[model samples]
Target chain A: MSGFEAATAVKRIGDGRYEADLDGDFGFAEALNGGYLMAVLDRAAVDASPHEHPISTAATFLRPAKPGRAELVVDTRKAGRTAATSLVGLVQDGRPVVEALITTGTLGAAAEPVFAGPAPAVPVPPLEECTSMLPDEGAEGFAGQVDMRFDRSTMGWLDGTPSGRPEIRAWFRLRDGYGPDAVSLALTVDALPPVALNLGSKGWAPTVELTWHMRAVPAPGWLAVHGTGRLLSDGWFDEEVEVWDSTGRLVAQSRQIARVGIGVRK
Target chain B: MSGFEAATAVKRIGDGRYEADLDGDFGFAEALNGGYLMAVLDRAAVDASPHEHPISTAATFLRPAKPGRAELVVDTRKAGRTAATSLVGLVQDGRPVVEALITTGTLGAAAEPVFAGPAPAVPVPPLEECTSMLPDEGAEGFAGQVDMRFDRSTMGWLDGTPSGRPEIRAWFRLRDGYGPDAVSLALTVDALPPVALNLGSKGWAPTVELTWHMRAVPAPGWLAVHGTGRLLSDGWFDEEVEVWDSTGRLVAQSRQIARVGIGVRK
Candidate 1:
């Protein structure tokens, strides 16, 4: 199987119990990406639910999870005509590394919005004009499997030029040839380098908790992600991101709070 | 107990199982408020875990919860040094009404921040300069239990003026003598009138799902709430709200997607 397939693959171990073998391609400093973790949980959540798409998911990162054998214990809270809700736990070493309350529903792939909102401001430039966040040294881990083309105007942090506003606009898609799906949208919502990075923060600002919803099925092409931070204070910052599909549909919305990076307090 | 007390009070019926009487004071029409439902779940989730504060909660509304009685089933997903996570279900009449994943943690009320960022940009007017959202006709239901003073600039929707932007800036506090706590913050995070109202929409916009986090224990005073909507399209819209304490400390942040109000469409 390809790396993305291997990293997100989930096998039904028993009734409501699912297992996945964690591979290193999705790790960051010995820990799996939070979005990747949610994708795995999404697999199990989808497996246990009657629906086909994840409507909403709130994930709490209890601890850093390493790549290895992981188990997802799914508990269906409710199965209804409109939606199905489940509580999934990503357990490792006899402990839950992450837990989520995922609500899933079905959305028609060809569904069209009756009245679509305008595309978010700041037109995305051509891919060549976008800045590649992947290290020039060579992409590794999670970054290797995703293509993120950040709008250059928002990447002032790299030069110590902080944009007074906390925001990041980027174009993103998976590099592994896997088309955008509910799982890829999960990663896309969180895949942006911390928005705080644009506000003069440095280093990795770990997310304490994240909540996201899949509003509609994303069309094939680059997803435009616009993220903005409301408040950056007291060792914490809150970011809200919206993912618009190539077809102009708002596919997903997410909000998260993370700890500030060391020596990079706003 | 007063109405607020009665509405939020939870009784431990057994290990991991708690019950609350669904009072009418917290209701809207024939259904209970989603924020109030989360407040009750927050109480149970916090109690079931060792933590003193609920740091994050993502709740999905499956069906309307009528006023009368409800139950919360708490399942501890993990207990770590920094955070305790659980999956909680709000059940009424033997049917699940709301399902949530709540992460609880102990935040020192007196803890100091090494670095704090700027407060949100909008300058909130004093309580006297703000426009009261509570209908002047007469206070009712959930509106009577909380105070939300919206900024006039963002209240253009009230007079059929679409500022062409989706936003709501307000000052909020509970009407009861009770001060802001983790539970109160839950309500406060969602207390604002839907932001879609600023985009030429009207009437009640019911939230389908909401996720919020408590970054710190709020001080005893009104919270400055700033909400912005990224998209208002099709039959749905998304709103993101950030609550700041009287001391200008960031307290809580939340995001939710809801359908457009009846007779209201883009």
Candidate 2:
């Protein structure tokens, strides 16, 4: 299995129950990324459902998840011919860490959009023209597991000259060669750093709640991730991200409301 | 109590449990609105929590909820000094109809935005120049309970012109004089007609999943609602709505994915 596949792999223990290991590679320092945790929970939902794709997911981050053994409890809410809905809970040490309501359905590989609105205005330069987010010293944990090339314009925060705008655009792909699919799309939608970073904020912005939808089957190659925030007020911010496949088709979309973290000048 | 307050009122039965009457006035024809259902659920979350406002909510509609007596089960997932999260379920006939993850907190009445993006470009004409959605025969059910004045440009769908766009902008408020607040903001964010209407679809478009966030305390009066869709493909469509208070401040935001109703031309 690829690194991502093995990292997110789950073993079925019984009906609607599975055991998984919280891979540290998907974490930042100590806590797991909200998107990475969502991908793991989504794997359980798809395995327990009759459908093949996780069409929509609403995830609430109750607490930060640490690296260790975790259990997933899937409570089937409704199973329908078109789609199935389930409440998948990620529990660690007998306490719920994250809970998600996932709706699964089958997506045709060749299905085309009946109608698509204007794409996001996040144009990226060539891969060579972009700067790698990998640290010069060495890549570890999340940075080592995913390859991200960021658009230079949005990376001013790295140099301490933070752009007042809250937006980030980048090209994302798994370092382990896992191709783009429904499960991978889950991770890709949240691959970019929090949009709050560009708003002159420092420290980690924890996602309070996030909802993402799989719009279509993505094509292979690196995915374009464009994230933007609408408002930042009262120690909270809301971000909307659009993931486009290499073929220029919007594959997945996500919106999350998160804490502003410490050191937010604006 | 006002109509909205009386209709969404819940009687505490026991610890983390409440009973409510699913008012038919919030329904369209036979089924209830997803936002209205969310308001009722939020009421339960707030009642069970030590917080003052429902800050975030992620709702999954398993089945259509009808008007009648329903039981709400609020399971406290996490409670902290700053915020609290609970899993609130609405059960009818012993079956789960809607499940929502609600996070509650207190919002300052005089809080100001640290940073806000440009408002949505859904301009509306003067109230008198706009057309009311109420039928000429007489307003009833949802239309009678809520007053909506639509922008003429987006109302082409009513006359079969079918704007060929996926968007709806309107002015919304309760006819019974219910002032704007966190709970009412829940309904106001989803009060606009489905954006898919302009795409030439007919019949009831049912919401599968919706997540909304309360950004600030709204000033009492009419709210400007702007809704738009990014994609409608493979029997599903995504809608995003922004609700601005009468003071021209963004108060609430919501995004939902629903099954495209039958009769879509393109």
Each prediction's whole-model lDDT (CA) = 0.81, 0.89
Interface RMSD of 2: 0.9
lDDT of 1 by residue, A124-232 (tens): 7777899887667378777788888988888888788867668888889888778688987888888887888877787888887898888888888988899887666
Candidate 1 per-residue lDDT over residues B53-85, each given as its tens digit: 887788888788888878889988777776777
> For model 2, what is the error of residue A153's alpha carbon versus the real structure, in angstroms, after optimal superposition?
0.4
Candidate 1: what lDDT?
A: 0.81
- For model 2, the superposed segments whose C-alpha errors exceed 4 Å read A136-138, B136-138
Considering only chain B, report the TM-score of each candidate against the true chain B: 0.93, 0.97
Instruction: Write candidate 2's Cα lDDT for A1-266 as tens digits.
Output: 76999888899999999999888989888889888899999999999999999999999898899998999999999999999999999999999999999999998888888889887765877788888976572688888888999999999998888788998888899988997889888888777888888889988998888999999999999898999999998898999999989988889999998888778895
DockQ of 2: 0.82
Q: Place model 2 in a CAPRI quality band.
A: high
